[model samples]
Target: MRCEDGHDDAAYVLGALSPAERAAYERHLATCSFCREAVADLSRVPDMLDRLEADEFARWLDPDHAVEPERPRKPQGRVKTFSVRLLSTAASIVLILVLGGGVFAWWWMGQQAPAEPVFGPAVAMSSIESTSPIAATIQLAGSESGTKVRMQCEYSVTAEPYNFKLIAYGPDGEKEQLGSWLARPGAEFSMDGGTRFTQGALARFELVRLDNTKMLVLDVK
Candidate 1:
């Protein structure tokens, strides 16, 4: 039940372990962080199952396929049921928070979208002119110690009061989002985004607007 056991512990936690093996593994998990985290991740299943119909849960957690390769798709059925009832309720709460007394909440959401990138010669990013509200950059890929190439710049988009998207591109042209940020006239922001990559050459990171689609390249290394 060591972290090294990974999905192996997941199987054991699910009672998928053999009687003898389960007893041995249970002893091991008492002192294992990896097993503890795996169990927590799988614990989400009880609530998910409770939210699903009896038949749906039975079908989803089918014993023949106890080792599901991915998370189950969202539940689809009457919302009045305990399983699906909170789905829309949760979404409504998020929408309400984003509105949060803003007069233009509807308008802002209509024009907003996540960031997109065009690599190599196709990029046409405008220069950020504002020196305030410095942009944050993070290192997402590397060894467990998280060595990375990163950089920072200032926010200069006219799309006020909205966060920007952060994306990273490797030397070989792979792209991934680091996350998003709310723009302030003059402030500093930073975070550590988690991504896995084997040791390799350097990669590039960029910050782009959620609207207007502008981009600014940060430093590499």
Candidate 2:
């Protein structure tokens, strides 16, 4: 019903339509928007053909006419026509199913997956004195149910002056990265909001302070 499907209708009027589809299309084109557009697009074909044919005829009759007919380049075929049509239809079906499946899977996962905890350490963190000159302890707490496990580090800066980072390791051998904010000079400094946990029965969080030390561990059971 759109103006874009211009084809065969023009070819039909020019008697170039395949015998199998000509009558059916001509009858349909009498009132169809698609057919109308197709005919309109093809209208120029006849005029062009007529001009070339007439010029050729004239030149043939009189050497003085001397005009060469410009032969239009024929369109090249890629895949066979039937194969292209079949492929197009199959591709459409696949595209629809893929999009539909993705939407359905997303909704299903959202509904079935348990919510993640906000902040918590899966295990206990031990401060490293030998590794770095920094003396710090990391503690963590997280919501039991939400979207992800959050890690909170409550640590102090020693006289040696140090910076640290907290790292969390998931059970699947994937390490979830929380951030290391600088411990404020006066009071305990804490950082939260680590990674999103999606669709696993259980996950663990471990915090490693820069100076590469494990300060605290919280387990989301």
Candidate 3:
């Protein structure tokens, strides 16, 4: 009993209409029961189309889809006209799903990937010598951006937490605050740091307490 005259349920379902067309169609829906029911029936189309992954969906949208050959055109009819509108809507849907899938894939990869590459090896920094009651080891690796540093440290003398900084001293009197962390007693912890100076330029690294006392010295030069 509702009007299906000029309203398109598929277009509404696939979000293919222009803004003005959409607003007009929505206004028409308020007075039409048939279009409303049709819209609800087609609402699941989008969810079905989204199952295609980015790569597969992009292949389907590629111009090579026409690589086979073209067929002779037939005379237009009412059914064909409606089908053409549906095909346009389907293209819009494919574009949206392809773009959405690509972005989702990119974001998912960034989440799963490491922020930086694995540094070389852990050097026994405790063997270097210490001026305080701390046990520590250092890892130094070269990177295009800078020198990457990793440390395993423990304040074995007490069970209290103490803040420490990885202070890097360079050959040209360059002092860089590479990184800092809180060292809890008894249990060992790992920390990370970086410096613009390469391993060769780095003269030494010091674990300095908050009051500027050097607890350990790791000579790289």
Candidate 4:
């Protein structure tokens, strides 16, 4: 069976699909790289949900209770099945929350967990130096899996039509090409990129032209 547009990934990760459908998708995942990657990415949702405290899960499951302890009692017998159903419903709700927004929401929620901080606070990059008449700033924020980058650029006509790329150097001396976009002359542009470097792992970020000329470099301190 072929994977159809990765729609089964969400349902499969949430265990919402029928057994037959799940089996078919598993077979498809064996041969389809796209569906395999989708399943791998969506599989993180359960791990994120696991980080929530038992009381937090209880509150999510039963928000009406005002004075609940951290460790809630386990459901017994038939109530266990009911609890499973409740958790399944909660998973559906979460899937709906992330369906349009993408898996980033799941990781973002984990990082913004209430009990404790999963990542350090946001850090702003140093001012950039460019040869052309361009103004840009890059901000790196911590996430559960890595660092998230937000880049904004205001370019003069001199820099128009240039293919620009963002590269990040991690603390371990690993380099990653985050993304690339075209910079239209006399226009402002903003793009979002991500790297697999954890907090404090990113050493520097470079904005380079397609011809391999360096435009700007921001060092993380």
Q: What are the TM-scores, per candidate, against the unseen true structure?
A: 0.34, 0.32, 0.46, 0.49
What digit string (tens of lDDT, one per residue) describes model 4 on residues 62-174?
Answer: 67968644476775889877766667557555654565674656655677643432333334434345346556777666665566677888778865477888888877678
Candidate closest to the true structure, highest lDDT:
4
Model 2 stretches astray by more than 4 angstroms: 1-146, 157-159, 184-186, 198-203
TM-score: the better of candidates 2 and 4? 4
Ten-residue region with minimum lDDT total, candidate 3: 124-133
The lDDT of model 1 is: 0.48
Local lDDT at 56 for model 3 = 50
The candidate, 1 or 4, that scores higher on TM-score is 4
Which digits, one per residue and each the tens of the lDDT, describe model 3 over residues 1-221? 22444346766776778999899999876544345545764575466554544445546667464353447888778887776556655654654454435754464456655366577766665433334557788887776556777888877755467887778788778777755677777767777656667778989888888888777887887
Task: Provide the global lDDT of candidate 3 against the true structure.
Answer: 0.66
Put the candidates in TM-score order, highest first. Answer: 4, 3, 1, 2
Clashing pairs in 1: 51-83, 133-186, 133-187, 149-221, 163-181
TM-score of 1: 0.34
Worst 10 residues of 2 by lDDT: 141-150
Local lDDT at 96 for model 1? 33
